[model samples]
Target chain A: MSRAALLVLADGRFPAGGHAHSGGAEPAVAEGRIRDADSLAAFCRGRLHTAGFTAAALVAAAPHGLDPLALDEAADARTPSPALRATARKLGRQMMRAARATWPGPDLDALARARPRGAHQPVVLGLTARSAGLGPEDAAHCVAYETVSGPATAVVRLLSLDPFHATAVLARLAPELDRVAEQAAEAARQQIDALPAASAPLLDITAEAHAAWPVRLFAS
Target chain B: MSVHARARLRAEPDGRGSTALPVLESAGPLALRRTRSPRPPYARVTVVGAMSAPLNGDRLAIEAEVAAGARLTVDAAAATVALPGPRPDADPSTYTVNLTVGEGAALHWLPEQLVSAHGSRLHQTTRVQLAATARLLLREEQILGRHGEPTGALTTRLTVHRAGRPLLDQQLTYGPDAPAGWDGPAVLAGHRAVGQLLLADPSFEDAPLPARLLGPTAALTPLAGPAVLVTAVAADARLLRGILDDAMRELLDGLKA
Candidate 1:
């Protein structure tokens, strides 16, 4: 359990193809729902507690020697929007590629063969964490942080707000982020059925709308 | 006061090839009535509330099954409201619905909106199981609060399984005690109404609908299985239904094609 491994996996430059997504920020920006730091904080907070929380639980549950395939199905069940599902799998495949290159394990090989298309990103991240010798809480923190970091970074590029303010937004959310990760990890210890199924209907709706956009800055 | 209610219904093909309700039992506050069906071979049933139900600590359950080759439609007469009980410290009311559609059978569940009134708490769960060849259409709508009122705590979970495989499972929370920022821009964005329509047909396996937006806030997307989900949110229930109705019309037309 190297703490440095946690830092590496949590890095925004991990090449997981997350750079292509705005985490629903693109559409919110188009709708003027997210204008500056204050609105961005609200949006990020909502996403972190709902979609982000669910994903972190999956990330935490992915290890523990659980079946990745079943976790993938659970991920599918948790994700109602088809566009977001596709985006998750695409990101999953990219993450798998990066993880295998860095860790090189048979577990990754077996999962890749099982899901030729790709598993869910959080599940893949969990497996990547296992191969990296990181714990479940570590995996949970990675996703919980990524959940807000991706949006904050995207907003910086999308709105051209002060980068300092954007970073400050993440800094302010640190306490809530820790709380979400802890709860997610705790829930992951239970039966998969008992895991959190929190959702954001507006996010699901907007992601579909974003996918259908004739012109857009993000893939979803 | 708290009450426990149960309703069970079974729709099957009759000797005349029309759908028959061989079993229809209503108890407590849940009243089930068979209504005339404009389309032959499809039995339609409407649920009428006999009293103000789902009060705090109440447990209500409805179970419906569609036998093979049968078609059924279940609807409600009016919006169901959640209100607090007499006690100052009351438990949240619970409503559980279980539905099953057999092979080659069809079930349409189009219940009215569920309104969460002030100072009430409700937890509703709906689960549906479909045979590999079954077709289903289900709709769920939630209005946070009545006119000029703040909302109570409300949580709803919808889970669907097709041929013993998970299709969709999601839980939504609103009002007090929900996660922080639920009404923020990323979740409801201050909207008071939210709803979704799920349509699953074997035909979708061969020809899936292309994902697209139906309105400013609603979009239709194909599920991994042979299903399509349309989600929408609006300032009020009427606008929410309008968006869903339009999407439903277009999707039903697609099924016909």
Candidate 2:
């Protein structure tokens, strides 16, 4: 497995439409649920286990040369929020574009052709990892980190919370991220149907509510 | 004990342009089916039950299909409350609903609350298939428990398909033990009552409903088919219902044919 490949996939700057979403932080912040780094850390932790874990399992499962279409359905079945689903497809499309340009493989090309509108982001991310010669653990780490990074990054802009503190929050979560990544990868090694179905209804609810907002920094 | 209801409505030409009525298919606990048209262009189907405790081994299945150019509305007369069965290790009550709407057909399935009693569980799955021009307004309202009671487990899944393509697929699992779902800022936010509404029609805009007026707790998501979705949660059921109604009105402009 290429360690550098992991870096490229995990980098928030890789441009997969991650910049536009708040990971449900905007609602939490709006509701005053995530006002500071402490609260933000709490929000990220909850998501990391629920949505984060679910996404990681999908991502981790993607590179095992499994069926992406079925994985896409699993991803859809796992996500209950329509806004989040839209965001996933939008980001999936963007990631597909970038992944095709970067890796240029049959796996990536086939998925892009099968889902012209785009597959789910986690499914695409995992396939991209396979193209990059990264393993399931790498895929899990990439998605698990993103589960928190996307929120931490958005919270900084939404609340004008100190960037340093937000960065610290991400740093403090590194250990938890590792644990979640391992758990997701382990789950992926099981039957695809038996993969983690962990969900956060509050996030699903808030994301649905946030999508209706006339003006918001994030698309979801 | 097990109980279930199934009904289907089809609209055909009435010698005018189009005024076909429903073709019904119902059985079992559904024997209590009642209908009264409040106005033209739509008829109402009220599903009710006798004083009942949906305990272990109880099953409720409702299947409704609307044929081409027809219109139908479904409403439940009362809440379906699930209680502990006569036996201690009773299985969860199962509520499975399947719906199909033909081209240019409209079906509104607005059911009442589904209350899960203490130490009981409810597993529900709703599957909907729509023709290219079908319009669907479906609402799934749920309360974890009665006022001042601990919430029970309800694992619900919804899947919608149009022209053989999957439009929306989602699963929601909530109870005391379902992991980081109920307590987070992203979900219930500590509130109890939750209402979900799905409206699919051409006039509906593919954007969030302008519903900040509804309350910060309420939200809307516009899907690719320009379908509209609203989910609101609060400790108060009335408030959640109000938010859902406002959202529906915003999407269909009073939901008139």
Candidate 3:
């Protein structure tokens, strides 16, 4: 697998439709839970270990050449919120579309056919990693970074928080992010049932509330 | 001491809900009761204390089954306070629930508040299986401690399956002494009390979801399994309950058929 594949998959600007979602910072921001750059960092950190960690593990598991259908189910069971589930599948559909155009493979085509609506994003991400000839660890890193980066970037727009401070927060979290991605890849090697189920209740809760917002920057 | 309670419900020939008398053991720490809602098509089973017994080292199991086309609702008569056993470090008490909702049936399990007392521990697991056509509206809430003191330990695991498809499978374990569990933002970010409501139906995906959850203290997550999972947390009990009830009302508003 080319190292560049990871950069492509991990890049935020990729047409994955991640730009519309806040990773659940909007409600917290609206409620005054996230006041500034520092609080934004704190929110991202919490999401990293919980949902980020879980997404990393799920993404890692997808490239294992295992049953993608079962992985999809595992993702569904692990995800407690319907809104997040819809976002995952929607992002997954977009990823499938983009990944097929860029990487073109039977695995991607079959998944698209089976889940015409879309599979969970992490599952699609892992399979996309496979299409790109990337390994489980590479996929894990992609999701682990995505779990936080989506919000770190969103809060800058939502709160007009300092972009440099947000980037610094991600920079400071680099070490922990590496640790989580590594741990997630290891967990993915276990039975699909054994994959991490760690979640941020606040994220789920906020995503649900955010989905109802008539006027919002993000789709989630 | 060990205690067990069982309730079974089935639809009658006239399409009304009927249930056998609840089965309970008199020599245990828990008692069971069944009641009519004073309204048609609604029934409730309540779990109450049989006697003043120490909850430490106690095991209580509640089992309920809803037959095809029937419905049943389970509720706790009052808040259950878990008291420490002779040894504070002893194993926590356990409350296990096993429920099955048959084809075209529904079950509403709304347990009251569960408070984990200082020096006390509680572990509860609720496993529910629903037929593809069945529906479930489940709500769970807990307070970290009785007064201001920190709770000893509390763990909750819930899983729901539709036909052979798994809808939700997750667990949460918390203790005040454990700095790693709740100190992180995802678990609570520092709040003690937590509440969750899950409404899963085959028609859920196309169904209209609540415009907003009850308060600022909570948020909801959407599941790919055609279900909506709502969660909230707060340091105060009243606030947490209010948040949960608000979420619950939204989920049940137009969905109940």
Candidate 4:
């Protein structure tokens, strides 16, 4: 497997349509809960351990020859908020398009045909990783990193905080991020039912609220 | 003392447009009492705890089934408080609940809040299965602590399946042993009470509710299926219940129409 492919896949500008969503950072900012780097770090940490861990597990399981459709169902099960589900599929479709262009394969083609509308982003990420000769751990790391990086980036734009400070927050989270990804990869080896179901109810609640915002910087 | 208990209840439709309970069994601390229903065609049953339950190492199970065309409502007399077991080091208690609704049946499972007191450890799982035409209204509330005290470790999982397809599955953890930052800005945000109301009705398939926020800390969203889920968090159980009760009224009114 080309290690460089991991960098390309994990790039923030991967054309995955993630830029449209704030990963719940927008709602927290509006509520005045995230005013600076410290609060943002706390928010990202809570997110990483809960929903982030769950997403990482899904991505990790996706590349191990697991059925994409079953993984899609599992993703839906883990996602209780309709708005988040819509956001995931939107990002998934965009990722699928980019992956098909970068590394086309029969597996990617079949899944794209099956979920013409879109699959969950993590499910597609796993498949995209597979098509690109990446493994489950690679997929897990990509998603785990994105889970916090997306929010950090959005908070920078929303709060007008220093980009360096945001980057520092992420750097500080590297250890926990690694831990979550490692655990997620291990959980992925178990039965689909045994996959982590950790949830952040506030994220689900705020995503629903964010979806209704007539004018917002982010889609979710 | 560690104990294993089970409660089984079944509601069937009578020929005269009413519901009848043909099976009702209670064992150990699970006391199932039949009660009067404010509305006709719906049987009401209240669960009363005969003893302190869900202590460490306790295994408790409650199973309820609503047959075709039947309507049943199950409620609890008081909140179920989780207390530490007698031994300082004891295994966490487990409570399992399974509910099923048949074709055209309706089940309203509205119980009191579950309080996880200090020094307690509990794991609870609730699963619901619904037929294509069934209607279900389920409410769940959790209070982290009694009052001004640190919460005990509590984990709860709720899974719902409609017509052989997953509708919702989520696991929530709280208290000392929970992951760090659980009470941070993006999660509970220092709220001691958390709850959700799930309403699954075929009528919603035609006119789904537009997703919106109920108040500052709550939101109502349409699910993938013909259902709506309302989630809220408040400073106390009373306030949490009030928020959910309001949402319940709104959703039930929408369902009736």
Candidate 5:
């Protein structure tokens, strides 16, 4: 079960449409905020600390045997940007489709149907993890890994970095991964009802600007 | 009331008289309320209840206590145009607004577009205080001049504080007199109009935005740490519309990120 779950969650082709997003790496690159492998790694680390931490914690804290539909609503209420919300729902819908094909559960189906016009990805992920009988700590680890790995992997694809070097970046992020998972576990235990929130205006501004560009590599 | 110096009106509310909320004299607790219909293609807003306020001669100092669930859509009867102060005045006309939202409360402060006429100088500041569970949505638009007219000089400072810590701090200075200031590639890029929209919620993770939404005319750059900064130039009204559309889409896209 552990091996299968890892394979499914870590696979780059999970159909979440994450491949289409550089996690802000493209604009960061265009603006010269990330130039080389080291800078890219550094950027991933920052994301892990901020947005990544919040997401992992929320996943870990999913109520025991919680309803997936409730989780999706929680996540939707938490998100503010219309574009980001759409992207999350797209990703969530894709991930749900893939997970259902592999795991196949009544809960997953019910959760998908319950989502509002637009549901967020993280909420669906947490529901999937819980339904699979995964522990909170493991669920937290998966969330953190995907949050950091999405961008790190995107950077490699965008910059054409060596595959081996990209693996090394992941290796270096292990400690951070552990730390974030541990923190998420603690937050889950506390069972805080609030969503993980960060006030990032510039990101919203850039994402808006990026959407209007005539040409782009990622879906945002 | 001591008439120490002449007061220049930076921006007057849509009506002729003062708003229903009384303007206070001292720094004690104050209340302010504002309501307006939604301008087309935007959301409606209404601000009600007690707020903090103080009087400074002809100028009014205002602070707002935004209760939980209160909504405010700031609209103008017309574009807010800043005119130059009378002669012998060194300080520019200014307005300072401070807002606070209680736990579980939501505040949407969407104001109409701003137009700065030539020879007009104005300084404006807006600060918001958010509780742990508070939600805030704010939008602002600034146009430098009417078509065919040279852009005027304008200075603006915006700060947001959450749970007693500063979350966002931004300052912009422009106009012909500040030649080196407005022309900088990072500042205005010679654009006559600019807009900003901010929404902060503590319950969700930061959404991931696509790179294509940022326009080519402006530079959409990320700052140190977690913040991202986007700046661009708009040569005319059409360009400004494009910029606003892109910005609004992105701000609402937070759900997908």
Candidate 6:
């Protein structure tokens, strides 16, 4: 099942340009909504239920041997924010680069060629998981976990939380991860052939506002 | 003043009851009071106004106003579910809401959720006018029916304009007679609750707190010019409400800062 490969893909330090992005932490920190560890934890939890749920559900539901381009388009539609779309594409590109180097496959190559403009991270992650022989449920877990962990880790770096404390925060999030992953898995099972839809207007507005800031730490 | 279907109920005198009270009352038309806050740079203000009318098959027209530099957010306590008339060949139930926001003012047009029951047909129209510098955070959510309950057909038309130019013009039609079309990717995607929040001429680049607090589910999208759109969609009403509350707090905080 290439557990090592999956870990590498999910690692925060995979050099997929995640380090430069706070997944909205930089802006939120500047705004003072997330000032400490407790606030950060609460914020991450909210994200997991909303955006994280949407992305993981889609990745988990992608049909076996599904076309990556179609998956990418669906992910793009689900993401209404242009700034977020750009960030997802950037992260996707870097992840694809890493995947091509670690586990080269014809399907991956086909998916890469199919996305001439850009690819979304969830789409690439799903393809990479399938290429590594991981099941849909596992793929969904990895996607959901990474989605939350990426921002949590970014908060640690941004807020200067002790590394140990950050780990603890991630540990506390384990139950939520399991719950959301189970929901994603069930959604995938129920609608394996269907596409994904997320129409969140407020999030898109914030993303748009964040992008125009002259100075910002996160890519999104 | 035009007369439509009208019915009034006065308090009945009870022999055993000590206090005299009016059980129910029906007015000539839906009584609507519009007030604007006397202040400058008012980001958003919300006012909820509703009246109970008899089930006397009348179409009510409501004119709501939000004065300049004053914001208003309106919503009913519950869905104004319309029922079929006594006669088989009766006119459908309809309600029209006219909204106006003055210059340099912001209005958040968020209404309570809507629920349509079986054999019910409703038509609603919302018209919004925004000033050049004024902003609007408007949203509407609708649920077809209660779980395991029958749902009737419903149609909604929305028109939004800024400086007399159309910003949004769309129509949504759904009902029992209509084909089950929510399962597709372009539609609800099997989601029971659907909501849309629109922010006009907002400072998109200035949302750091909400971006950080909301994390992944909440994102900001840059539109042409100075407008931005923030969105978050969830499976249930609770999650949706939470997201909306967080987003509003962040936005209000941003304005204060």
Model 5 per-residue lDDT at A216: 80
When summed lDDT is taken over every stretch of 10 residues in candidate 2 chain B, the lowest stretch is B205-214
lDDT string for model 3 (A1-220, tens) is: 8999889878888988889888887777787777877677777777887778878988898787778999899888988777788889999999999999889889889999999999999999999999999999888988888888888888899888888988998898888888988999999999876676766667776777777779988787
Residue range B75-100, candidate 5, lDDT tens digits: 33344566554443444656566778
Which ranges of candidate 2 are over 4 A from the true structure? A1-4, A11-21, A35-38, A57-102, A109-120, A135-141, A152-220, B1-31, B51-53, B202-213, B254-257
Q: Rate the local accuracy (lDDT) of all candidates.
A: 0.91, 0.77, 0.76, 0.91, 0.57, 0.58
Query: Per-residue lDDT of A62-181 in model 5, one digit per residue for the tens?
Result: 634444554554444333334555777888888788777776777677777776343567666776776666777777788788876776777777788777887788898898899878
What is the per-residue lDDT of model 1 for residues A1-220, given as tens digits with 9 covering 90 to 100?
Answer: 9999898889888888888889999999999999999999999999999999999999999777778898899899888788899999999999999999998798899999999889999999999999999988889999999999888999999999899999999999999999999999899998777778899988998898788779888888
lDDT of 4 at B242: 94
Candidate 4 regions exceeding 4 Å error are: none
**Tens-digit per-residue lDDT, B77-127, candidate 2:** 788787766766667777788888888888888888878766777787888
True contacts kept of each: 0.83, 0.29, 0.50, 0.68, 0.03, 0.11
iRMS per model in Å? 0.9, 3.9, 3.0, 1.2, 11.1, 10.9
Q: Which ranges of candidate 6 are over 4 A from the true structure?
A: A190-203, B1-257
State TM-scores per candidate. 0.97, 0.78, 0.81, 0.97, 0.52, 0.52
lDDT of 3 at A67: 87
The B-chain TM-score of model 6 reads 0.67
Q: Clash totals for all models, in order?
A: 0, 10, 11, 0, 50, 32
Best candidate, DockQ-wise?
1
lDDT of 4 by residue, B1-257 (tens): 79999899999998899999999999788899999899998999999999988888889999999998999999999899998979878888889999999999999999999999999999999999999999999999999988998999999999898998888888889888887778998789889999989999988888888888888889887887788888899999999999999999988887776
In model 5 chain A, where is the ten-residue run with the lowest total lDDT? A191-200
